[model samples]
Target chain A: MRIGFIGFGEVGYEMSKGFLTEDPQAQFFVYDPLYEKEETQQRAKKTHATLFSDPQSVAKETLDVLFVAVPAPFAEDAWRSIWSELNEETLHVDLTTASAQVKQRLGEDMLNEKRTFIDGAIMGALKVYQHKVPIMVSGTGSTSLIDWGKSTHMNLTYAGDLPGDATNIKFIRSIFTKGLSALLHEVMQAADKLALDDIILDSITRTMDKEPFEQIINRLISSNVIHSQRREKEMENVIDFLNSHGIEPQMTKATRDKLKMITQANILEKNQGDPPKDWKQVMRLVNCT
Target chain B: MRIGFIGFGEVGYEMSKGFLTEDPQAQFFVYDPLYEKEETQQRAKKTHATLFSDPQSVAKETLDVLFVAVPAPFAEDAWRSIWSELNEETLHVDLTTASAQVKQRLGEDMLNEKRTFIDGAIMGALKVYQHKVPIMVSGTGSTSLIDWGKSTHMNLTYAGDLPGDATNIKFIRSIFTKGLSALLHEVMQAADKLALDDIILDSITRTMDKEPFEQIINRLISSNVIHSQRREKEMENVIDFLNSHGIEPQMTKATRDKLKMITQANILEKNQGDPPKDWKQVMRLVNCT
Candidate 1:
């Protein structure tokens, strides 16, 4: 099987190496602006692959699979440049962090052109997971790639038939992971100032470990109405404290606003003293407010 | 030792119940507005404890320990109302989510009045951990509480000698826990909308279980400089996508801003292609920017 890679950057390079490890005899074509670098040249030589100067040339090959692992900002341009070179049989997989809407547009365009396009959103650190990294794919033509991926021991899931379903899942997941990491960073600063980062981290780990994610969400949402007022008041003080400390407190402010909004919505009024049974109900209440 | 609880609220009730379980002969005096409630009255009778109508009465009992478990906003007021009633030897322990400033002010006031004040910040769900829940304490009066807490099988940590140190630790910790919960709730809504909550939660658990929290933090901070641009672009799209779905995108927007700020700082410029050796260094770079 011949595989072509467009951008030989961090994730793309790691994935290419994984392919070589799985099947050393796999034919390969690569194109990267840094192809002339000693590292890139040596990698290509070891894999018995040809290094093309242009993305178009790499796509010109009638490969079994072509992975487009470019940066998200350049994903659309790269797709358009490779459009003329892809054959109807080539399975084009994109691993960029593009939004679902962007992925959907590309998926529609490729389908109209009688080609297969798979929106493969990779999750986790590429360096750590390597070939075992999880990828969520969604498109009309993702079934074949999913099968191929599983056969090679790749952690791949077929999200849905919608072009951007996989991307949507990835972005939504980011709202938790990246958002948490950013908040943690800000928190670490404040904790460090107090010289209590270790103790605070210990507390965080304890809370996270002691409860299942589902239970935590249910508990927090169900008690939202009962505690919103207290939380809002406390969070206001928190926001002011953080601001005085020279931090912007974006997340803190948002948390305070969300709590206040939930209180204003009066979700408790609907239940007459009982809390919402599900997080979805709470969310609906939030949106309504 | 005679123990008095001034709030007799959710957390106060849990802690008192735990204390009773640990020492069946223990005596308690509780003061709460809901003391007339059948549940509170029954609990007091079951524990063979006294009930008081006012915080002042609870403080006036000449008890060895007095626990002030009021809401954060009222924490200061509760302390002031009880100050005149407390004897010189009474150990005052406050378990509220009050700001560090508020805690410090109360601590100083109590100390000036010739009483020991321990700024104790309880961590975790009172309903879950009960008396075994972790508490971080600060101020000069914390050492005795730590010894007492350990003897009674309560999880306690002496954060530092600073009056507001414990509250500082708690608020910083709250930034991460509350921020993550809010982000998770938003993600859950989006996932529920797509009927992918199960799959996404599975993926989240897998990733979390695959790596230790420390390792995850290190890896993110270390490779941050290299991937900041990609992450910033991806997060920007995430913010837009979340907004399009009617989610307020507070956490998402904060995540995007943090990423952009880090990239703009260009920490890599100082390292000259080398990643930071520790998270503290990364944070320093972020603060510098």
Candidate 2:
């Protein structure tokens, strides 16, 4: 089997390591602007991959499979630069953290050229999963890619048939992962102010002992109407306290805004006679408003 | 032992049930506007607590300990309504989810009036823990209150001498819990649009197989310099995608704002030569900028 990689940055490097570790007999080719850099050169030599000076040369190598592991900002440009070199036989796959729109455009362009394009997005840290990361793939060629990936012990999921479904799933998933990080960052700042960092962390981790998702959903629905007014006021106070401590409570501020919107919409008052029975019902009330 | 409850709402009622279950011999008095409601009356009867028409009457019972479990907005009013009724022998502990400023004011007022006031904040769902919920307490009287709670098998922590320290911690913790709910709501709505709700949820819960806090912090720091630019752009796309789908991405919007702030401050560029070694280092760089 022959393979080519574009962009030997952190993700690209880790991916190469995983690929070589898993399939040592597979031939490899590489093309990155930093190919001449000492670290890049050493990595290429260590992996025993044939390195090419330009993307055109890597594309012209006529590899059966290609992984475009460029940075998100440079992904579209990179694909365009190597567009002419790829033919119908090359199964071109993207591994950039790009938007659905960008992925859809590239996928459509490739399909127009009678080439296989699989929109792929990694859902975990490259350092942790390397090439075996959970990759959400979409497009007509996704099934074949998933089959190929599974054979090599690479974790891949065929998201849907649409060009951008996989990327969309990934961006939406970011709402959970990145949002959690931002929340923790804000909380840690406050914990530091009180010199209660360790205790606060311990308290939070302990809460994780329970099913937080169920607890959260139950509390949200059961107390949605009973406490919205007071909760909103407390959130306003949170904004003040965070500001006083020189921290921008972006998430807290948004929470306050949302709470205010809820009260203004008067959904609770309207549903007072017949309150929501569950979290889903509560969401329906919210949406109706 | 004599005890009085200043409210008969959801939290107040659950607490009464738990306390009575643990100490059946303890005398109880209650006061709330809803005390006349069927549910409140039924709960008080079941718990064998004496119902009072007003906070003043409940205070006049000369209780050994009193719990203020009113809503956050009405907490101050409830305290003031019974201020003249409380005496030196009464240990008044608050369980409302109020702002630190409000808790501090009431605590100071109680101290000046020769009554013990412990600023306490419940750290879990009241429905789950009831009177035994993990309560973080702070103030001059917190130690004694914690000891009293411990005697009854209640989970209590003495935070510090200051009146508002415990409340501060609770408000800070809210950022994580409420922030998480907001993120989940946003993601669920997007998933619903694509009819991929189950798969998206499965993916997120799987990611939780790892230590989320450590994973989040590590990813945030390691990719701080390399992916910030791409991430910020992707977030912008997330905003547009969410809007196009008619879902207000409150958490997603806040995340974008935060990422923009990080990039705008250019902290990564300054620390390029010596990148942040950990989450704390990353935060220090953020604070420095």
Candidate 3:
């Protein structure tokens, strides 16, 4: 079966390989805008699948299933450009962290073309993609299409007749789980500043005792991961949207303020290259732990 | 040994009962302006402890250890008005959740007089007080005093040769763990509104297989407990106080905003009742397994 995978990002590439990992005999074709990056190029070398130059080329490949491994809201403008290029025979399944509203638009298009559209979301990270993480798929008229997920070595859990059930779950959970990681970064630091770092930890531990406190603290606590720092602003954007919707942002606001104070406050003072006061203190705090 | 307890509120009364639970021979006495509630009254009835009418009566009894379980800041001022009535031999242990500033003042006062002062923070609910959950204590002249914790059944973990060490840990952990519970509330609801709750639960279960998700989510998720409907206002107060110290309020703003809209826009307006939403629905949003 020819499978056309779009958007070879981190999750995208992992899933593409996941499909192959489940069934070696399956023919795979992939396309990503950033596929020329050194990492993507190296990934392509190992996968040994058809790498298309553009979306149209992947679309032209007489694919049985068109897997959209793109990012959240994968494409703006209602995915019109990508939709217009797809063959009517191919089925489309989105594995991105997308919203139901965006999926509704694409759902209308898929229904019009009489093609199967599966609302899908990956429940686990890349390394453990298909092994234990059953990819949850749901939507109108998807009972027949999920067989592809099952056949391709993916444990497909049929999520009932909702147009965007799985992705909806992924986004909401991410808002908190990832949001907690962000929350930990902000709260721990704030408490640490008050010279109540241990007290802060105890207050959280409460009646529950499980993981080594340090591991949970470090993962949730800030370790100065420059890459993760951007999440503060992104969380702010989410909180702002929640605020616009008249809902409280909770940890998202705390997260944003912390990020803003650390990242942006320095820009105003012209302090460059020096780590955030928080970044430095977190290290010292953890050492004391 | 004559052990004295001030403030026969739930925590103090429970801790005193816990003392009796393990060591029935340990004499217990309680003193509070207000009478103990039903739970405490029942405990005191069963334990057969003497109830003193005022703090002076307990102090005049010349107790080996005086466990002050009263509320803080307010209690700080409360103690000030009545402190001159107490005996100098009393080793004061404040298990109340007082601020660092209050502990510092009290610690300094006791230090100058050569009286032992132990600052402690109670962890877990009263149920776990003597059974398992630890009560952390911080103070140098604490060992001889805390030996009664063993004879009279208190699970005490001492920090260092300082008055603030134990309280510091409790406060630091509180910032993240309790903050997590608050953060979970907002995100869980976000999932609930979106109707992607199951996926949210599955994602966390799959992603964080080792962590204790159930207890954490139960404490934070709104469905289980009625998160203060006025949570936004209360959280803002929590954040503002923390922020006044140059330490940020971690989940303060976001937690407030995340729920204010939903509670105000959805639950408060559409549904009416305590814990108006089902707890499972809320936990499903936190996606903690």
Candidate 4:
């Protein structure tokens, strides 16, 4: 098997290293702007991957798979540089952190008789999962990548048959995960200030882990429509408490504002002062408003 | 047992009803500005509790337990009105959604030799948990409340001996829970807009429930110091994506701003470019700067 990487950064290096573990005889071709750097060269040597000076040089190889692992801004340029030179049968999997729109545009640009374009969104920490990091893929080429992934022990899930579906799911998922990380950071910061970090973390962990996440999500979203007004006031108290302790309540303030927006929507009045049956009902009402 | 509630709202009504199921012989006394309202009258009748005209009347009953469950703004006033009239042996549990500082002030005001002041922070939805809602208590009177709670099956956790410790913990916890709720709301809204609500919810649920919450929290906080810059840029992409879809992106915006703050703190540079071992190290570095 022959594989090519358009950008040899952390992700490219880690993925190449992981792939080598599965197929020792598989040949690797790589091109990177930083190919001359000591670190990049060292990484290349560690994986025993042959390096090319440019994307076009790497693309000329008869590769089974081509992974574009550049930064989001550089993703399009790198793909374009190698597009015409690549074998039509080679699977082109984009693994950049680009927006779904950008991925969709790339997918459209790759449309042709035999070329396959897979929008691959890495959904886990590459440092931990390496090449086996959960990658959600969509687009015309997702099936080929999934089939290949099965043999190579790659963690790949087909999101849909649309070009940017995988990236869309990932970006939407980030709305919750990234927000949660920030929220926890602020909570822990306040806990640290109060010397209650251990206790607070324990309490939060128990509360979150006590129930299935679906139930928690349901309860929170359902009650939000009815209780947003009261919750908005409660958040004011929280903001006051955090501010008094010299912690800027950025996330908390956003929470309060969001709650305030819900309250102002008068969802309770619209629902006759009753909680929605579940999050879906609330979402339905919210979208209508 | 004689119990009094200074506010005869949902919490007071539900708690009284719950206590009746546990101890039907327990007498209930209640007072609220809405005592004259038909709903308040109906609630009082159902709970078989006597409704008093003012806080003083309820306090003068020489009760075994006195619950002040008014709104946070009215909590201090209600306590002040009833403080002198209440028997010293009565356990005064403040369950208002007040800031920790307000609770602490009330705790300080109730620091008499015989009086027991418990700062009670209700930590669950009353409509669901009712009287059994998890309540965290602190201050001089926490032990007395906890002791009584044992027989009544009240969900009580003693936070600490400090007056406002329970409120502090609850307030800190709100920073996470409320923020999460808002984040989920925004995510689900965007998902609905894309007609991918079910898939997005399933994806988020799976990600969140895959591991113990402690491990998740640790991983996010630890990686944050090292990856905040990258995550910040990712959040920009998220904002653009959300904005393009007509979602407000409030919580996502906050997440991005927070990541920007962490990046600006130069935590990665301070750690010599290595990820922190855990959240504590990140907190330590965060606190120092």
Candidate 5:
């Protein structure tokens, strides 16, 4: 089956690789501005994938599926504007963390064009990309596509046969995962400021007592070190949720503000790199003093 | 051992009953303006336990342990002024859900007066009172008092030997427990407006996909009906924390705003009863339509 993918960044690259792993003979069409990045372009060539020159060219080439794996705060208006430029109405799958409202809106337009729209929000990290990452896909035309996804080794779960179902589910669950990670970062730092580090750790363990807040906290810190930039924006959304709840987000507020402050201070080894040691050391040691 | 409890309210009343059930003969010098309605007071009269006239009397009279089950949003000036009247440096234990800062400030002042201040926070519903509810206590005075508590039938867990430890621990856990409850309430209402209740529920359960958010959402909705007013205030704090993270909280913000609307509608029987519904219905149904 010939499949074409657009915007081969973090998620898209992995997805195209997954299809290749399933069937080496699977002819693939991929396009990414980053294909020029060191070894990426070579890997695309080695996998026997054709990198398309433009969206129109990619659309002209008849393909089994057109996967859209792009960054969220998605290009909705831009997508709609450019969407008309494409000539074909093929099965289009979106594997982005988009809002349910956006999916619902896009679903309507895609259906009118006689194409299939599947909201497949990948719930795994980039590491599990081509391997066995579980993707929750929900839409009017979802079940039909899941069969094809299975043949291509995509771990897909049908949340329900509705357009916005999977995205809504992903956002809800994300409230705990990403939101809590951001919260933990703040609280750990608060513990440091108040000089109550040991007690805070004890509380985290107790919070994790018969739960998993401890392990979750560690991963959040690691993720912040890696995706510190995205985390900053994500945490802003989290604080808005926290306020609406009337719960005191003791640490999360500090973490987000501190990130802003660091950025304002113009301290960047890389765009989204972790904060310096002074900040990192804030709650690393849980001492009485 | 004889103990005196000032503030015979929901938490106080229930905790005393647990003490009574554990040791029928345990003496309690109880004091409260609403001493008339206290089941503990009535039961104490039936069991012939001693009663004190006032807060001052409890301290002056023969009382081994002093349990201050005061309502929180504790006034710093008022608490300090009244606490100063104690004169005697007795075994003072506070089991109020006061702010961590309040606990720290008060703990320091009490310590200066050579008083053993144990920071204690109740860890379960007030209904459970004594039976299953665990008490988390921590402070410089915790070791000695926790020993006394163990000798007598107090359900206590020493969080750490530090001032303000217990409240910090409780509030942090509340960040998840009560915070999520409010978040759940908001989105459930939003789902109602969208007419996708089943979709949201299925998505959350699937996305939450076998984690504490499932059990946490279950417990918050099923049992612990936090006062909406308190929930509102608590959500504010969580929101402040989320703002620090730079993440946009969809459900949490929706939940928070809806809760404000719930507060506005005056759903609480007297405008201050348990939240609009038991958390279970809140999680499964309440605004879920």
Candidate 6:
């Protein structure tokens, strides 16, 4: 097997190392502007991958797969530099954390009858999962990569046939995960003000770990829709308490605003004072309003 | 034992029913403005408790415990209506969802060597747990109520000797749980726009359910501190994606602002470019800035 990497940064280095573990005889080629950097050289030596000064040479190698692992902003430049030199049979996978629109545009521009362009989104922490990090791919070429992934021991999931479906899922997922991190940061700030950091952490941990994620999400959304008025009052009290302790409650303020919005929307009355069975119903009702 | 309630609302009704199951012979007294309502009357008769139109009568019953379960705005009125008539031996448990400052003020005003004032905060859904709802109490009288709670099969935790400690804990916890609900609502809005509600929920559920709560929190906080710049960029992409889908991205916008704040604070440089070992360190660093 032969493989090529357009950018031998952390991702390319880690993935190359992971690939070598599964296929020891597989030949590797890499192109990176920082190829002369000691760290980059060390990574290339460790993976025993040949390094090149430009992307065109790597693309011309007629490899089975060519991964574009540059930063999001530079992804197009990398693609533009290599596409013209790539063989028809080589799978071109773009793994940058670009927006779905950008990925879709790139996939559309690169579309051809014989050439395969896979829009790939790394879904887990590469530092922890390395090459086996869960990767979701969408586009015309995703299925072929999934079939080939069987021997490479890569964790790959086909999201959809659309070029940007994988990136769309990832971006939507970030709204929850990143929003959660921001909320945690604000909570910790309040906990510090109260000198109750340990206690607060323990309390929330118990609450979150007590139920399955689906159950917790359902209960929160349903209860939120049903009791928005009551929760709005509770949040006012929380905001007041945090303010009294000299802490600025940014995220808490947003939470209060959200609860107030729900109450003002009259969702409880719309639902006849019954809590929704799941979050999807809550979304539908709220969105309809 | 004689137990009196200053309010015969949902909380008082459920708790009285729960108490009877444990101590069938326990005497119960109640007082609320809504005592004549059919629902209140039904609950009172079902629990075999006598209802009084005035709080003074319930207070004069020489009860072992007197629970003030009125709404926050009326908590002071209920307390004033009954305190002067209460026997010195009765424990006064304030279960209103009042502000901690209000609870502390009440506790201070009621403080005396002979009388016991307990600031009680219900920590779970009364509708679900009913009488067994987890309750946290703080004040001079909390330990005594905890002792009595043993025979009643109630879930109770002692917070501190300070009057508002339980309320403070509950309020701080709201910052996290309520913030989470708001985040989920926004995410669902975006998911609805993308028509990826099920996929997004499944993705987040998998991420959340894959780890223990403490570990998840630690990872989020630490990684957030370390990679704020990268995450800020990712959030920008998310905002663009959500906006393109016609969703407002309110919570996602706040999340981006928070990440920008962290990056602007130079947390990565301040932390020597390493992720904090735990959330506490992240809190300390962010707070220092």
What is the interface root-mean-square deviation of candidate 4? 0.9
A1-289 in candidate 3: lDDT tens per residue? 6787787667656666766667676677778877677776777666676776677677778888777777665553325557667655677777665666667667777777876677876765566564335667777556766665566666677776666766556545544554454344344334434445454445455434556433443343332234235546345444443444333345555645555544543322233444325322333322222
First chain of model 2: TM-score?
0.79
| Tens digits of lDDT, candidate 2, A67-134 | 88887789899999988888988778888876778888988888888788888888777889888987
Instruction: For model 6, state the Cα shift of residue B204 in Å.
Output: 2.0
lDDT of 1 at A280: 67
* lDDT (Cα, tens digit) per residue for candidate 1, span A36-68: 898888877766778998899999888888988
Q: What tens digits encode model 5's per-residue C-alpha lDDT throughout B1-289? A: 6676676666656666677777887776766656666564685575455665556666666667777776665434424534744544356777776665677888788767877777887776667556337778877678787777776666788777665677766654544433333233333333433444555555554444355443443333332233445455545544543444333344344445544544454434442455434322332222222
Q: How far does residue A69 in candidate 1 sit from its true spot (Å)?
A: 5.5
Q: How far in Å is the alpha carbon of B74 misplaced in model 6? A: 3.7
DockQ of each: 0.43, 0.40, 0.16, 0.75, 0.06, 0.68
**Which candidate leads the pack in lDDT?**
4
* Winner on lDDT (1 vs 2): 1
Q: For model 3, how does the per-residue alpha-carbon lDDT over B172-244 read when each residue is reduced to its tens digit?
A: 4544443444344334334344445455555554555455644443334443124435445445544543344
Please report, in order, the local distance difference test score of every candidate based on alpha carbons: 0.78, 0.77, 0.58, 0.87, 0.57, 0.84
Candidate 1 displacement at residue A239 in angstroms: 0.8
Model 5 Cα lDDT, one tens digit per residue, A94-184:
7766666688788888777776788887776665467368788888668877777777767888877677778766554544433333233
Residue A96 accuracy (lDDT) in model 5: 64
Error of 2 at A31 (Å): 6.4
Index of the highest-TM-score prediction? 4
Query: What is candidate 4's lDDT per residue for A233-258, written digit by digit as tens?
Result: 88887888888888888899899999
Q: What is the TM-score of each candidate against the true structure?
A: 0.78, 0.77, 0.60, 0.89, 0.60, 0.88
* Model 6 TM-score on a 0 to 1 scale: 0.88
Q: Which candidate, 2 or 5, has the higher lDDT?
A: 2
> How many angstroms is residue B278 displaced in model 4 relative to the true structure, after the best TM-score fit?
2.6
Tell how far residue A19 is off in model 6, in angstroms. Answer: 3.1
Docking class of 2: acceptable
